[model samples]
Target: MNYFVFGGSGFIGTHLINLLSKKYPNSVVYNLDIKENKQNGKAIYINCDVRKSIELDVPITSNDIVINLAAVHTTPGHPDHEYFETNILGAENVTAFAERHNVKKLLFTSSIAPYGASEEMKTEITLPMPNTPYGISKLVAEKIHMIWQIKKNTERQLTIVRPGVVFGKGENGNFTRLYWGIKKHRFFYPGRKDTIKASIYVKELVNFMLYRIEMDKTDVEIYNCTYEPAFTIEEISNAMMKATGMKRTIYKIPGGALKFAAGVIGALGGKSFGIHPDRVKKLMISTNISGKKLKDSGYKFQYSFDEALKDWYKDNDNLYLK
Candidate 1:
């Protein structure tokens, strides 16, 4: 068996590559990415852009698995056209290549962004109402991959995992910024102390991917990847402290004052600081995504909120706040 992973040099993809290497020692692993892996994985890296036609000379059998992780996922970072261009086009290109090569198994990582920002719990049955360019692009990309799977009736297998905020190793996103904020004693609560942030650790995410791909009984399997109830801001902060042995005096600041301060900080020192005035509203908005579908599938979570933090803290994270 051969594993072909597009955009495998990225955060989640790197972890997937590492796991694939260990689990299938004899199997060849090919990572088609624009850049090389920074964490030293066993997968051979090949520079290939997914937005256009993907050309490679690797031997691929019909049994080989192809995972599409290539996309412009960062919100508020890219222009509207960039997201559609990379995400939508990449999906079209990747699925087309899979079809031509007769690759039966395909995996994709879609985000909970399609459900949009909501305090209400959203499940697989919920209708997608994406608001941002990133969310809209991801939703479209999911549909594109779905069409590929459905075209073959029962012959093609596709697994779509809609994850919330994914954090781990090389992640430079929300969790990493929060960790740095708490460590520096600069972080403070904006409003409601219990805002839910649906999330999953990278290791658990990839492990679940491996589990689901083999266990999927249908031609297409779609499930949410997040903690069942979601983690409250307080819960996440406390876990971060306990895991890293970091001490910070938590203070509650008025939303306006916090926003002003965040604006100044974000302006003075880019997104690296984690706190931005424009993003302050998100701290209070609850993203209550339901993971019941995955939980009911008999896949036991290997790490709890605290355990995931402890593992990430111990690893010292590959990117940002290093």
Candidate 2:
């Protein structure tokens, strides 16, 4: 089967492409992205932005599968309008391409952000109440994909995955920030160390996506892609310390004080320390998302947090201090 990935240069996309190439040596894979990066020799790369209309030189047919992974997803990174421009508009263009080519299946990588910042455990049954522009835009994109599925009726299969914070070797997001802090021996507990942080290792997430597609499940199926029994901040820190063999003096600070400091830092346009009000606020909220749907479907997660951390450290030894 041919695989067409919209955003095939990003961290998750890169891992997915490599996995597909290794697993299915004979299958053809096409990557469409704005930037060109070194990819597996088996995959073809095409420079195209999903924000505008997507016109691929290769012929896409009903036998092929389309995976939409492109989006402006970094929070507090892009302006509000930019999220809508890339996510919403990008979804439209990708869906149009699938419709035009009559692709048999389309898989989308949405985010848990659409569940909004909440202390409650979120599942597939929970109603989306997205507050941030990124979250709102992702929810809208999911709806657009659903519309296409409904239009296609039984001819097309749609799978929507709302992944939590995904982390791996190439990641430079929240988890990476934590790793850097721990490596420097300056890591601290922002508030309650017991606050839950939902996450999935990049490899496990990619594996799950492939498993679902191979199952050939018909119609629309949505799953929150995170490991079961989400890890607490303290547990995550302990795991990282164990994995890297670098134990630090973990300090505890009051939530209110941290918020005030973050506010001052934000006012000063200070992102030097990676501590801003928005980030601090997010840290305080518990993202206790559930992957019960995926679990109930008889899918077993391959890597635990400890295993993932070990793999990350093994791959990027330079990130740690000597």
- All models, RMSD in angstroms: 2.0, 1.9
- Misplaced by over 4 Å in model 1 are 38-40, 269-272, 317-322
Evaluate residue 11 in candidate 1 and report its C-alpha lDDT on the 0 to 100 scale. 89
Task: Tell me how far the alpha carbon of residue 217 in candidate 2 is from the true structure, in angstroms, after superposition.
Answer: 2.6
Which tens-of-lDDT digit does each residue in 24-135 have in candidate 2? 8898998899997685456799988998888888776788989999999998889999999999999999999999998879999999999998899999989999999999
What would the per-residue lDDT of candidate 1 be over residues 76-155, giving only the tens digit for each residue?
A: 67778999999999999999999999988999999998988878889998999998888999999999999999988578
Task: For residue 23, give model 2's deviation from the true position in Å.
Answer: 1.0
* Clashes, model 1: 0
Model 1 residue 214 CA deviation (Å) reads: 1.6
Locate the minimum summed-lDDT window of 10 residues in model 1.
313-322
Those runs of model 2 whose alpha carbons end farther than 4 Å from true positions after fitting are: 39-41, 263-270, 318-322
Error of 1 at 20 (Å): 0.3
Query: CA lDDT of each candidate?
Result: 0.86, 0.86
Give me the overall lDDT of model 1. 0.86
